[model samples]
Target: MTGKTTFEIFLATVPGLEAVLCDEVRHKGFRSPSVVPGGVTIRGGWPEVWRANLWVRGTSRVLARIDSFHVTHLAQLDHRARQVAWADILRPEVPFRVEATCATSRIYHAGAAAERITRAIHETIGAPHADNDDGVLVRARFDQNVCTLSVDTSGDLLHRRGHKEAVNRAPIRETMASLFLRQCGYSGQEPVVDPLCGSGTFILEAAEIAARLNPGRSRHFAFEKLATFDAEAWERMRTVKSERIPSVRFYGSDRDEGAVAMSEANAARAGITDFVTFARATISELQPPEGPVGLVIANPPYGTRIGDKKSLIPLYRALGQTLLARFSGWRVGIVTTESGLAHATGLPFLPPPAPVPHGGLRVTLFQTAPLP
Candidate 1:
């Protein structure tokens, strides 16, 4: 499809960071972006959908609202699904999976709905089916008996970024790291440091943002597999403008040599090795890079994810003291499940927003303005 028509484009993210994602989408030039419960929504066409999948970070996935109708029963759903112009979007040769959700609707059985949609696709589109969540994902949702159909444009989550072959334990997700960086008022203009960098997620995100690199540059998307995909147009979209040399730098340090190596390798894969620095150093050995201070963001080991709570007190205390003694003007953003650990940092944090669901645990980003 050409980029003229308008449609609903949904950008999903971790629940608590919807507002942050909304800001990013709006700032990234998405038209009329609005914050929803779990994500943000805008009205755009197929080209917008592809651009969103390519440029926007902090989103878990991108979905395009392909069609919708009112269906009260399984038969109605099946008939409506078959009538949809599937050939316009889905490929007859590609594999597909249908995921259904029902809420306060007469057709309350999601499984039955999914089966009906699957049969419809098989019968009308002549596409093979996949059991796992792979390739094209057709999302069918019923709310008050109003069924809406959407296609997952992003095959894998955006955080994967097609890089980072190695990782440390309980590493922060790239999506969450980008949102946390935005929460700390980072906009790719200032330097960023992560003393407890694990797999260098935050540092890499900061470096990419500063360098104006597209998050989807090295990755492929489900949209390319769809019948609606236009290869020539996509090539134009993939060609990003000049990658301006960023004036600022990103620094990351970890106590584990393996983590440092992992960060270095990941940075090299991302093609931003010149703008990033990774080293092995404990929190006490952490020192600010030369020049103006910026932001210090860390995903330290929380008790539930690593060790016991009591055993982590000294780590938090030491981190706080070292920051106070060395990095006075820099701001801090820490992701932790427990409030006590954040409070132990002794940084003047403003009131935090609601906790976000992460790895089956509720986590929050505690941030401070430029330190006094």
Candidate 2:
């Protein structure tokens, strides 16, 4: 497809962070973006889809809407699906898969819907269809009797930035970490500290942002397999050389020696070790990095995920007390599932935002102004 051709592109994000994702999209200079229930929508063509996958940080996936129509039954869906010019986007030699979901529609069988779409693609475009490990994904949703077809341009979830092999339990995804950093008003102009850094997601994400590195630089995208793909153009887009040397350094510390090692290794893999520091230190031993008062953000062990609820109270108390005593002049952002644990910190927090769903639990960012 030509870059001039316009189409709807959906930037999928976690439920509560749609606004934040939209803000990021808009700031990235994409055309008129609007917030929806689960994501943000913008109008563009194939290049925009590829660029979105390349530059945007908070989106979980980017879906390029192919077609949509109202259908009451399976026969109509099959007919309309066949009418779509799949060859324009999908290459016949590439393997593709269709996943379907039905809700409040007369055609209610998800498997049946997927089968029909698969048949349509096979018969019309001659593309090989498979159920396993296909690089191209077609998402068909039948909502309120209207079926919408979209192509998943991002093969892997955006958080898997092709780095960071080591992960601690209950680690925050890189996408959510970026959005939460944005929510805390972090502009990458100052230092960031994650006392409970698990595999250094926040510190690495902040480092990348400060350096203006493209999140999708190291990964391959599904769009590369499509007929619309321009290899030379993509090479030019990904290798634009826009990174800068950050003025401040990011810090991560954990009591576990293994976690400290994991963070160090992850930082080295991300090519930002020169701009980050990781060490083994408990929350009680937390100290601010000298030279600037920045943001101290931590995704501590929520009780449900790591331990008993009552047992974590003292941990929260100690974290709060240490920050209150020594980290004055620094802002704080804590991600937790329980309000009680957050309140135990005794920091004066601003009003909380909507809780974001993470790992089957709704987690909220409890943020505070610069500590006095």
Candidate 3:
């Protein structure tokens, strides 16, 4: 594999997260990234994929597209599976696994399909097959009468930054919060406050970005074990750093003291504790930083997984009144699975930009401008 090996990279995200994920990829310096429904597809070799795994903060998983073909039946699936140049993609010495999904095709038995694909790779490519339930997963999606094959370059979801030791009920994913922040036009230049800062995910994500910290710097990726992986090139790309430093405008507070402490610990682990302030304060008593215009972003509980909806209405109303009263000239972004709950904020607000699917639920990212 030489001469700028071209491979397909599939970036996966929750539904409606495509735009933000695309923006993050472009921000990380990918040239002409293309957006698809559930992800963005870009053409690059191992270097680009490696950098994506390291720098993209908004994506759920990064998959390298190795092969694809039309499969109407089990025999056709076996034939196409055997035809792929598996030796180029998988090393005979490395142990691997296969995962498959099928829809709208004659190959309806996903287990049998996966078994045939696995056998082909094992016999033809000489790659050892690992049992299911292993950490590493190879995903196969059969949709619209086409079979798409990809290898999960990310061992775990990218949002599991391994530093969040605790989580509150209805906690927001760090990646989702970061993408929502960007969608709200956060440039990290002004104060960012998360009032209902469960587990401190939003604040910590902002702090890390403001501090110019790479999200993947502390984690390992599956591509590191690939035969075509270039160690020296990966190290060089990983070592590239920006000279930007974080300011003290980032803050987070929660009514729950336990959440405040968890946010503090997460910030410390990410090495941005100095750039953020966490406090146990209710939304009614929340105060903006003493400065110019800034951003207030939060993923308040929606009574779906955690709290009582009837009880949370007061919290939402208080949040709305507090922001309207104290946060003039500042920008606000709120994420909630229930728009009706978000509407209780009661600020003269525009309709949400769009609703995005998150964790088997649909969430809308709502924004508002401070009054004159």
Candidate 4:
């Protein structure tokens, strides 16, 4: 623990957004990172973890690499776990939890694996382990006979920013929204309109980003309780010089009254109510305030839950027509779980990008240029 240690920072991404997420990380100044199927790993320390949590717009969670070794059996796992210098990383006063997942490994029992790891920490390092309200979580990923250990620095998933009290059916996560926005080349410079905005996630994220607000500003991080926690350093890092007033570049709309109300409240809580305008409007009635060129990012219904496929086709067609008629010269980004549904839009859009796994479903982000 004396010399500088190489720690792995895990950046989780939506399935198709791995490349986009990787590009975002690199563009944000991360050095020499490797991308995996679901995420990317970068070499860094606690400071890097803090920076990722604050600045990474597309990542769902940021985990710190702790230790990794091959364990073919439970005894080997227990031995290796006990051998790890947990005391050097975790403080004795902070409570922690162990969550393990085993695949194709000799130690396939997840419950037993977790228990063994927890016991090792308690007996070897004198750390407090609990089943609930654990500030830190030890994640075990066992695959191909290799077991990797990571510490969860992000307590709640980054999408749960603790601001939204209400969410509509099939609500999009803030991380996914942010990723879609970035995929559309959103730089917080032009107007963004989400016609089918459910619960206002996309609009709210856009508004916050435009205002230069840190996504994790109002939340508490697990790293705060670590032994190496520096309160003063964290406070200085969180402060950014920006105006409190909202800009006029963000807008959202939904046909559901309740969804609109919830979005407005959520935006107000994030201090961007004056900048974001949410109204009850359908795709056919949607219109941008001033529209030469901007971005229209929307998460439309996939018709998997309540609506029939045939009836929903018209809605998609109408959306396509509306975008073609009123939003010419603008850029459009559409996210949906069904590619067939997206095709119904009938816009001269590019082929859907790689599908991203979300909430047990595969989602594709489709982009289109303004109609001429």
- Top-lDDT candidate index: 2
lDDT by residue for model 4 (1-372), tens: 324556778999777678878987898788677888888889887788888888787888898878888889999888989988788778887788899898898889999989999999888867788759655888998888888888888888888887877899878899888888888888777888889888899998888878878788888888887765777888888775553444456888989998899999998888787788889997878876874478888888776664566668888889988988888788888888776777888878786677877777788888986656
Model 3 residue 261 distance off true place after TM-score fit, in angstroms: 0.9
RMSD of each: 1.7, 1.5, 2.1, 2.1
Per-residue lDDT tens digits for candidate 3, residues 1-372, read 223378788888877778888988888788678989888988888788888888888888899888777778888888888887777767788888888998887778889988988898899968778855543466778887688888888887899877787888867887888889898888677779889888898888888888788888888888887767888988888888873776656889988899898889888888887788999997878988886778888888777654587778888899999998998898888888777688888876666777877777788888887654
Badly placed stretches (over 4 Å) of model 3 are: 1-4, 305-307
Ranking by lDDT, best first? 2, 1, 4, 3
lDDT of 2 by residue, 59-122 (tens): 9999999888999988888898988879898999999999999999999999999999999999
After superposition, candidate 1 runs with Cα above 4 Å error: 1-4, 305-307
Q: Which structure among the candidates has the greatest TM-score?
A: 2
Residue pairs with colliding backbones in model 1 are none
- Pick the winner on TM-score between candidates 1 and 3: 1
Q: Against the hidden reference, what TM-scores do the models get?
A: 0.97, 0.97, 0.94, 0.93
After TM-score superposition, what is the CA distance of residue 39 in candidate 2 from its true location, in Å?
0.4
Task: For model 4, name the residue pairs that clash.
Answer: 16-356
Estimate the overall C-alpha local distance difference test score of candidate 2.
0.92
Q: After superposition, which runs of candidate 4 have C-alpha atoms over 4 Å from their true positions?
A: 242-248, 305-307
